[model samples]
Target: MKNYNKYARSYFMPPKTSMKWMEKEYVTKAPKWCSVDLRDGNQALIVPMNLAEKLEYFQLLVDLGFKEIEVGFPAASETEFTFLRTLIEQDLIPADVTVQVLTQSREHIIRKTFDALQGVRKAVVHLYNSTSVAQREQVFKKSKEEIIQIAVSGAELLTSCAAETEGDFTFQYSPESFTGTEIDFALDICNQVLDVWKPGVDNEVIINLPATVSLSMPHVYASQIEYMSEHLKYREHVILSIHPHNDRGTGVADAELGMLAGADRVEGTLFGNGERTGNVDIVTLALNLYSHGIDPELNFERIPDVLKVYERITKMKVPERHPYGGELVFTAFSGSHQDAIAKGIKWREDNAEPYWNVPYLLIDPTDIGREYEGDIIRINSQSGKGGIAYILEQTYGLDLPIQMRESFGYRVKSISDHLHKELGSAEIYTIFEQEYINLNKPIQFIDYSFKSGEQFETMIEVKKDGVIHEFTGIGNGRLDAISQVIQSQLNISYSNLLYKEHALGTGSDSKAVSYVGITNESGTIYWGCGIDVDIMTSSIKALFSAVNKLILDQ
Candidate 1:
């Protein structure tokens, strides 16, 4: 076997110095947003959406107040062409909104793209070509001069074809993999295209520069965009757009910094669903603005429902760890976090002004559609007595004693460790009742039967310490029946008891856990829990537990 010298090569690649130059050169402004969800997002999916789903998603984008939407590349497929035709023929295009379409720099496809836009009210024809040295040599097998010719020729074709349309049309061009392209050559090509098309202040053109594959730091990316924005001749007429990919997982930061560098428009998909890693998450970007006391204009409260629709259409699951819209985004499992959130919420409730200094809360949960109940009460190994007690006190208003809270905290830690997952509020309540509330009481329920649909009748039998007590009664439900039987047999008088039933597990084999909170004449509340395969049996057990607690308190 031939032995090779593993230490022959250097560990690190030489850093590119131009990155610093690019960062210092550019400063950007907020760009007009144009969502490519219907076109680019669909193409990136394994099972692309059909016509109906496309139209539905298009309407949703329109409803989101996006004035410009990339509908599809009409010349690519028959389905795409028909979809654009449908938008035109049905008059579905909103009066103010402009539909954008993407196409290669090829003449035939450009002609077909224009042919589809005949009756459209307003449209943007986006033309792009690969311009990087690597792409020019490797992908297109063309020299620098050839690639420039391809781009300029495509722009001229778009200008001539757009003239035949009745509705006003604008031109937009992108240099694919623009960040890595030589700055001087990139400018030369863009300037030449502008000259051929004569896109001016009256007929503005968008010059979108995508960090197609992020090759360096965010500052480097910012510098590239800023350099281009400052050097472009028709600065006022040019709409500088940035489309960053998440190859290095810095797409959002890159887009944001690029904006500060002078980017005027953002092109992205919802939740950042696009090619590998994904695009800059528009949800995160928009919500970041909202959280910072800046108005993002987009209403994010409808995000969860919107995500559901996108999931169905795209057949992709939104990761639970996704920021702002994930299942676990707002859930707190840490002891300190839960304690801070609990205190924050209480302070907000008591104070006249908003409590802005809440420690664990980054943003108000209610700003989105999530409730406060679901925000802070996640149980895990790192969680503590405060979280457990908060759930018990909040859900049932049965404040646990200090010692009891410590005991319950141990139980919670055990359960979280065993399951290796966070416990929901209902699960916490069930576990607490089973371990603490019913620990000393030995009430063995033999069986319970109920006959319903008219006058409800229920019979229950209890064997306590080997002595059987049987009772028959008539009431609203099995709970009321069991309560009446217990009162009559045990001769106990209680003031008021409220019963609530919740699911232990989901789907077919779901067990029901019932909670009964009984209040005495003194207005002190005692809570109890019951669990069983049947809901009625659970209710009866819960009621009995509450009664037993009432007697103990007395």
Candidate 2:
């Protein structure tokens, strides 16, 4: 922070601006997605992926619906050249999928890049040259006309090499470090290259504008894209694309707004893996469109599996907070968030809603192969009644009463808070079993029999300390009859008993779950749960458990 005075704004704005992109609401349609994971993303890794890993990643990209994949910069290293050869010779490249290879303006590199592409079904020979002022002054030390000639020469070499090579080839040109280049110079070089290629209906050229070193805010980048998209030559035949890096932590914003600025394609990597802060996250960018009811034309339904493959091969961890694919992205730890999510899910199900309108969730976790049980309502010290209750009902088939849920929620939260850790579903269920269900204490129910008559009569046996006691009670029902006996004979003062029952899950061996709540002296409610194959037995056990709980508390 102390050296902030040394830095200045390095990015340049366009000579003129229409700001037409500002008028657009959002990216209404999906862009043609190009995965540069193997090329740009792979090069950024600490230990680049091996041939086998690159092959696996390419297959994954093909499976994920990417029509164009930048396999590698074949001219960069022997590993890259070998990887491209493996894809071509082994016929790993799919029929509809086109593999792209990057090359510089130098003839030998361009020639070798062509050698790797030879006999390929289809490929893109991506030619790039540094056109930024800094690159000209410090890196290459060239003038404006000289840099434009570099791009033009590369563009010419691409066309000639494609003619000589025995494969179907497309041309792509990028003015590398585009965001740092003067807007007019960037346009001049790109136009010079377009003139060399002369793309038309049959031959399509991709004019990739990369924020190689993003040095501006998102709006500036969007305006830059808008200006270039309007003035680019052979505009109808060109597939205008953007490849943004996260130098400013706005790669996703740049990609989104750039799309609205008439760009037709996006070149990025999964989870934004690349040099420095990485490329725009294609997964996040695509899903952002999907959230707006637009199909991003990519398959992300099994994002967890995709992430697993990404990390396994790339050896790069997707942080827990990464959008869409991270482990904790769908988890709600806050009490109010959990409660609102629980209620929203129920509302949607009850009304049979047509859209994903759950509160606090941009998209359904289940839709992306995540679960609502453990994934959504994760239990922690910050968890609330609705979330705890949701976990119980969804995972364990025990829906606690609304009032009882608040009491039980606090109990679970206290344990989690004391333990200083998150509680899993099994642990939560264990807590429930220990604290509420079938609790046999001073008032343990040994056996009971019911008789139907003018008044419901019941004879029940119980254990107190180390002795067995018998009591006869009469009331409207079996549970009420036992309650009557306990109140009268034992002098236990309790009233306002609330009970509810539901069948847990389905099939012949399914258990009946019962809940009971009783208000004791001073108006405090004690809650209990019971589970059995028989409804009456479960109810009786629940009543005993609730009563014993009160006795223990007293």
**Model 2 C-alpha lDDT per residue in residues 158-253, reported as the tens digit of each score:** 888888889888899999999999898888889889999999999999999999988999999999999899899999999999999999899999
For each candidate in the order shown, give its overall lDDT on alpha carbons. Answer: 0.79, 0.91
Q: Which 10-residue window of candidate 1 scores lowest in summed lDDT?
A: 7-16
Instruction: Write the residue-wise lDDT of candidate 1 on 1-554 in tens digits.
Output: 46676424211112333333344433322357889888778888999999999999998888777889999999999999999999999999989899999999999999999988889988989999998877887788998899999999999898888777687888999998886688778888998888887767688999998888877778777777777787787888899998988888998988888887778888888888888888888788877767767666666777778888889989988888788888778888888788777777778778955545666667886778877676646778889888877887677555554544665688788989999987888898778766534333555567777788665677778877778877787777657777777777767777576766677656898777777766677776666667777877776677777776677667
- Cα displacement (angstroms), candidate 2, residue 102, comes to 0.4
RMSD, model 2, all Cα superposed? Answer: 1.2
In model 1, the Cα lDDT at residue 539 comes to 69
Top-scoring candidate (lDDT) = 2
TM-score of 2: 0.98
Candidate 2, residue 489: how far the Cα is off, in Å: 1.7
Clashes of 1: 12
